[model samples]
Target: MDFSFGPEDERFRAQARAWLAAHLVGPYAGLKGRGGPGSEHEGAEDRRGWERELGADGWIGLGWDRAHGGYGNRGATLTQQVVWAEEYARAQAPGRVGHIGENLLAPTLLAYGSPAQRDRFLPPIARGEELWCQGYSEPEAGSDLAGIRTAATLDAGDSGYRITGQKIWTSLAHEADWCFVLARTEAGSRRHHGLSFLLVPMDQPGRIEVRPIRQLSGTSEFNEVFFDGAAARAEHVVGGAGGGWQVAMGLLALERGVSTLVQQIGFASELGEVVRVALRTGAADEPTVRDRLVRQWAELQSMRWNALRTLGAQSGTGGQGRPGGADPGAASVAKLLWGGWHQRLGELAMQVRGAPAAVGPYDWSADRPYELDALQRLFLFTRADTIYGGSDEIQRTIIAERVLGLPKGARPST
Candidate 1:
């Protein structure tokens, strides 16, 4: 129903808009249109400044508890979070330095971590002081996360475990000071039940190495990580041993929710850019281009509203990780729709630009100089949207088994 924000919510939205207007100057005005603040070395101060700026304003962790350097959940409505995501998209602020930390790890810590763990990790993450990365997707384990081979052996003295393994596709590993990783704690035990989650420091002397991966767009953002004889203190473990499957599932729920909402909002700005470019180049008048743009706008609006409904329902009823709960399956639907739409929009953009879209990568400043690099990169990257964060096939399976009560599929013997 009523999609409109009530009086108090509207007031909060107005306040946020005003604050963002004053503090955020050029380039940061549109969330999706703007990119990350330079590379690791170049962005250090800007990243810190943005983090501290948001942290000081109490906007860094929208759902975090107040006692831990956050504004605290404070009965914060999901609508508020959605508004923040959408508005921040409009604001074009630099993306989070520790996305894995803030979105996945922080939530898990709050839900299942010890009080000490919470105190140790949450504040710096909120303040942007300590960046974190994820060590989940290994060379052997990407979509089949249950198939991870990284192991942690318990110490003989009843102390911490020794970790040695390699992780690939680790986004931001080189810049991260910390990582939330999954390791097989039990030998000869297979499946998801034998795993454990560890909070690891990246700056340690031995047992770890970080090598950045260059993307097709020439960005060294993701990395390959190796850990040898690394020690993880017992207290760093979240949940119990053998309970990592459950924790991983919960973390996936967090990932799906955050990605579906924040990312869709972010993608909307790109669509807007497409429209602006078309209008600037006189291509907006073409019948087919006009129809596609209109279709995209409609699809985006529909998807965003559906996401809002899911958020409101989850917030009011509290069924994020419960069986027969609202279920995180809503995220799958969002991802499928948004991912497909993004891919299509990129195609349409290229078509509209025609030969001009093939030009060499020029700086975005020159008039009529189409930044084909950005368009090409998006077109290329959006091809993987349905594959990463659980593939489209996986999402359909989730809907079939969990949401539709389909019979479980049998697995092959290894």
Candidate 2:
């Protein structure tokens, strides 16, 4: 596949950059999160507001059709989206607040959800009116997802099931209006067979409880959700009964393929921020820090290439499943490489900051909060990069068996 963006893509980039220059101004110009550079900065509302603006302008769902509340620009190819990712990477756009909606749920709905389901969910999500969070990782089922104990039994006579189970490590549940969950409906089937995907409301219910989980950065980035006989709609069912595995796999494809792109770009931007700090503080003069920064930059580029390849595949340009497409092995490789890159970058950033990296928020000037807080938070979060998206060991095993065509190991005893 052609890696270079032709004249068409270059024009798209120009238009996007120009529009961003005009609209992303004043308070909304800065990055999100703790220790950001500016005191007058954008908040979640600002991010949502910008999303609404993108939606209104048809820039929000850059890849989706116009009828589905997107900008309906068919001119932009998957390459153009990659270009958009690049430009946004340069501008330091907010790392998607409704990632579940935009990346995982939206695409899944487009592919699997009914027209009514699409009509109800897509527009609100595109408009930033409804936020979504994933409800996949349960207490007993992280990597071994088929072991999910969450039950969504059919009710006597109704629109939905009586869902009762606990989902842990649910990201952004605090702000989400809906959750795409995986629950078991069949009792006799093996790990991957008896599951179904459910779209659940967070507020209404049998009993909805959300408890925030603190990260190493001392921030509550994820939550634990407890559901007790939550009423869901039959329409919310993504795939047929005992098909949750397929639906969940598709969602994971979105997770590892599309959603991962947004995050990897965001992380790459953070790596760039490290360079900016190095330049600002004269840390680049240090050979160690300079070499580390250079390596991180190279890794970021490699990841971008991989992401482009995935997008190209999605656009039907290449192999059956792009590297990081639906294949678990491919996703595992992407996750492993991405996690390593992020962790190394964080370490390098802290090293560049030296003693100041450990200093609390109070030690830094308010103007430099972006660097300070990012360094702190990134340092904390990077530790889990290997664990959250599936452990590094699992990734290696996938690569060995699937990618390398190695002999399969004996199945682990449950």
Candidate 3:
């Protein structure tokens, strides 16, 4: 597939760049390069404002099909979408706060939701008026998603269901306005058979509670959420009740396309910082350190190529979030490639610093939180890189069974 952009794409890139340059100023000036994977605690309120700024200018949902109500704004061609992703990253714009709603939930709704369901949920996401968090991972079913025990019973009058269970490792739950949850809807059902995907509001004080889970980096971007009979309107179910497993899997596959470009850009910046540290500390002289850095550089380039290929395939197949579509191995392979690569980069970050990487500048005697350096945060946070968003083992299992057509591995009895 051709990877080059033409004159029209370049014009779109200029338009995206000019708009971001004009708006990412004034009160939003300080937001540049703030809030991402390791630094999610920084400037969250400002980032929310920035999200609204994006919506106001019709920049929130550029890839959604116009036939499907153009939820956020006008639809752009795949090339234009990629161009916008490139410019947004190159501008060093603040990490987006609306990505979960815009990228994950909105796409799923379009693919599987009824027109009524789409009409109700898509507009708020497009306008940056709502924030969403995923609720697939539970205390016992992080990787084995089918084992989720969270139950939602049909409430009185059959108007909705009442959800009662706990969800852990929920990213940005504290700031989310809603959560798309997977729960057991069938009383006697086990595993994936009886699960339902429910859209739940976060404002019920007595019913829903969010408690932040402090990380080693001293940030609480991940949270432990509790639901005590939280109400979910019957109409809010996506992909219909008792069929959530398919909907949940579809959302995971939506990770293809321009989102991959955004990730590669972030990886590139992090690598640049590590190289700068190596040069300043004279660690670049070490053959071993130099070898690892070269490997990182090469692997990053290869991943970008793979991402472009995947994007091309998705574009040919009518864009992302189309259920039961795209190469099954694509998402798993990307996950494996980046997860381990990021973990290794985090290790290299400390190795370049030598003995000083372990120590912090803050005095232990102080009662306040310690301010850790960038490298420190990266190292601590990446320890879970291989664990979250489907572990390395899980990805490999998927590729082996689904793509290679090998004998399926043993799964626990439901």
- The RMSD of every model to the true structure, in order and in angstroms, is 3.9, 4.1, 1.6
Candidate 3 clash pair list: none
Answer with 2 or 3, whichever has the higher TM-score: 3
Q: What's the lDDT for all of these models?
A: 0.72, 0.72, 0.88
lDDT tens per residue, model 1, 227-301: 998888888888877777777777776665544677777667778878888898888989989999999999988
- Work out the TM-score per prediction: 0.88, 0.87, 0.96
Question: What's the CA RMSD of model 1 in angstroms?
Answer: 3.9
The global Cα lDDT (0 to 1) of model 1 is: 0.72
Error of 2 at 283 (Å): 4.5
- Measured by TM-score, the strongest candidate is 3
Residue 230 local lDDT, model 1: 83
Q: Which structure is stronger by TM-score: 1 or 2?
A: 1
Error of 3 at 104 (Å): 0.3
